[model samples]
Target: MPNIVEPKLISGNANLPLAKAVARRMSMHRGMSVGLVDARVERFNDAEIFVEVYENVRGEDMFIIQPTSRPANDNLMELLIIADALRRSSAARITAVIPYFGYARQDRRTKARTPISAKLVANLIHEAGIERVLTMDLHAAQIQGFFDIPVDNLYAAPIYALDILHHFKDVSDVMVVSPDVGGVTRARELATRINAPLAIVDKRRERAGEVAEMTVIGDVTGKRCIIVDDICDTAGTLCKAAEVLMSKGATEVHAYTTHGVLSGPAVERVSNSVLKSLVITDSIEPTAEIKACPNIRIVPTAPMFAQAILNIWNGTSVSSLFERETLGPIYEGMYSAA
Candidate 1:
């Protein structure tokens, strides 16, 4: 028998489909083991949460597959409780594979009284007995520092890059865009891999969930533009940026983001926007409205995620995953025209 027979990966109600997909890749079979109960969390008459883990998880290397996305509080609590339960049951090593880590945007406190909720969330996980974390495209990368345990910040860029290259053939007409100034580095990384020119969307924030239109830093007129972002929550920034680009005479607009934390009317907003299509990885399961819309395309990150899981299982260096950006330089010419 193989030394690593199998890691007993467990899933809560958060996003069963994504968890199942990940399981299918890791385990030859995708069925959940018996006795693993729903860690069923519910609200009381007074409105507090109750958690229950109905299984005996002794000496098991457990991986809890849950994305702390929308209903952020509840999901976050669910993860914490599940971890607590597993720890009590003597699980050898518990790994929290949260494809989407919420409160990640609050890594830096904007106001004097504001709290860095991301750090708090990490602390909760640590106290709950999570040995390690596996997540993708955190809103703020520094949130990893909040925890002392090993964290595998997987990259979905390579998957997106491959998809773009597969779907689109013409290179000259394509341009990758950063929806806001902050996401320029991520956008540049993806832009470099495709051998495409990069564009930046310069905008000011009038308030949260609202962006003040400023200017397009790079020329996108008549080019097939793909906006690369880490998270797309309300879709306000994305839709607004798409509109700004379209108004500036961009030929077409498409977006590839890692986490689709589509909260509220985000699906409706994206469907009705000027964007030709919005593609997101399965970090957060799509809402009902998102599935009903034809404009949204979901590309699978299963292959890369599966690879990362295998590498971690074998104790391999996953840093080579970022080779797309470091292996070759994409910008070759149009340098000395000035």
Candidate 2:
């Protein structure tokens, strides 16, 4: 029989705590010792990135856990360089476990002269010799097609549904609201899981950073509203949506998102907004500002990611790990895409 190569986990500087958590979960689930590979990633005096893998990965299945978050350019380059180094070391296979895939919002061109940066990023990863990719809740589902390699796009509805159910005992009083038209499908999935009604926020974007107006479509009067989306960047859309929901007689408005990019003035906006609270997964490492914001709560995605990675390594079906019956149509769509 051929030698059985155990899976190895490697992490970039993007989010070390999340990587450690995933490693611990994997070790616990497998009933064996699983540790991260020693890979030093740093920047030179001139700001040039350098990567050095201290251990041999020859004939090993390497999984690199790196989220392309803030300082996106630097973090992105770091991931690419690390993958290139692993390829040179003859690792049996390289899978990039990107919990938060940056540049995903740029999957298409809104203007004539603009570039589809997401596709370019996908090409770069393929050029770096990555064999597969595992990501969660892409800004645009179609972004998966940009990659030639197999892409697994995980959904956060299952996790969020559980949390919402636990927090709100009376599900009938709670309603799921999509902050914009584009997010209706995502909100619908969560609504179906929690058995709650659905609402949509009709908003027109005048420009990139500004939302011209917002109108609530469904009845939110006296209802506790839960707004759902994939990413929370500047918090502009979420904050505005919450305010509109409240003005429309929503008793409370809470927001949940998969990835919290939390860019400029996001924390400040969220804190002052009418939202009761904002819950996000730890896909991107939270900054000091995010941590200090009392209204922001972070849920862990490590356990889910850990299970998915293990299934991939063991050549098992990952969709089995989630509740297909509860997920319904979303599960069917994701499976077809995979």
Candidate 3:
């Protein structure tokens, strides 16, 4: 209930650059002393994770910025171990800032005897003494209910919209296409932001991680198209969807996704596909192959995360960050960040 004298940010080995970038953005605000905690999250000889915090965090507001991305198991363990360390140190409030929540795709049971791993992960975090969670663009919104604590699921739609507008000055010919029926809502939200028409690609997936059939439900003839989705792992769907749209007479195709989980041959697929460009936020650290791809572009989410952190720390409204007029200034001339 007392004012925070200083905000402590500690990160794991997942995404140190993003953590540092958020720290830099936080420093721009007055009266907020944001710095990295003097801690070490190292691995032992047996591949076991060990965390040691050297600073005194008693009664201080602490945030652990660790995205559970690739090597999900190790990174996830680091977050849990770090939170436990902070709790034992008697921190006033500990928030787990996970940009990408691993195992999120398994939010529900798909078949008999299947495990709902997302909920299990949520329970693990809850049991680890974290009071809240800060993540972005969850695979399923209902995953928030899996946790008893407050969960802030931020969206990258505003950031994507800003970058979309910057690239395309004329929105009259732009069409937003959802690669599948499930993503229509997310695609429509971006469509509304950019004032573009919406379309849907009906696809059938006979097996996991593979699309068997795809049908364009709307006319994309001669219009510049943009496919919207939350994650792009393997990129088989996006690459195929782009081909389908172009075959239907779309002049050009582009894609915007939140987490660029370009695992396996996703980078190669995007590079060789018909998509003119693929824009993604830095929710997950980019791979070397992804960085080398000319068609792939990355936008920073540090400023947005910084503002949300400040709001939450000050007990203000976090939803207002998505308002149209307010987004321009936050992302103005923000092609890249530290």
Best candidate (score: lDDT): 3
lDDT of 2 by residue, 145-222 (tens): 999999998888887876776667678889999988899999999999889999999999888879999999999999
Question: Candidate 3 residues 77-142, lDDT tens each?
Answer: 999999999999899999999999999999999899999999999999999999999999999999
Tell me model 1's lDDT, rounded to 2 decimals: 0.78
Which model, 2 or 3, shows the larger lDDT?
3
What is the TM-score ranking, best to worst? Answer: 3, 2, 1
Top-scoring candidate (TM-score)? 3
Residue pairs with backbone overlap in model 3: none
Q: Give the Cα-based TM-score of candidate 2 against the true structure.
A: 0.94
TM-score of each: 0.88, 0.94, 0.97
Task: List the candidate numbers ranked by lDDT, top first.
Answer: 3, 2, 1
- Model 1 backbone overlap count: 0
| Steric clash count of candidate 2 | 0
List candidate 1 stretches off by more than 4 Å. Answer: 1-5, 29-56, 323-338
Worst 10 residues of 2 by lDDT: 329-338
Q: In candidate 2, which residue pairs get closer than 3 Å at backbone N, Cα or C atoms, i.e. clash?
A: none
The CA lDDT of each predicted structure is: 0.78, 0.89, 0.90
For model 3, state the Cα shift of residue 82 in Å: 0.3
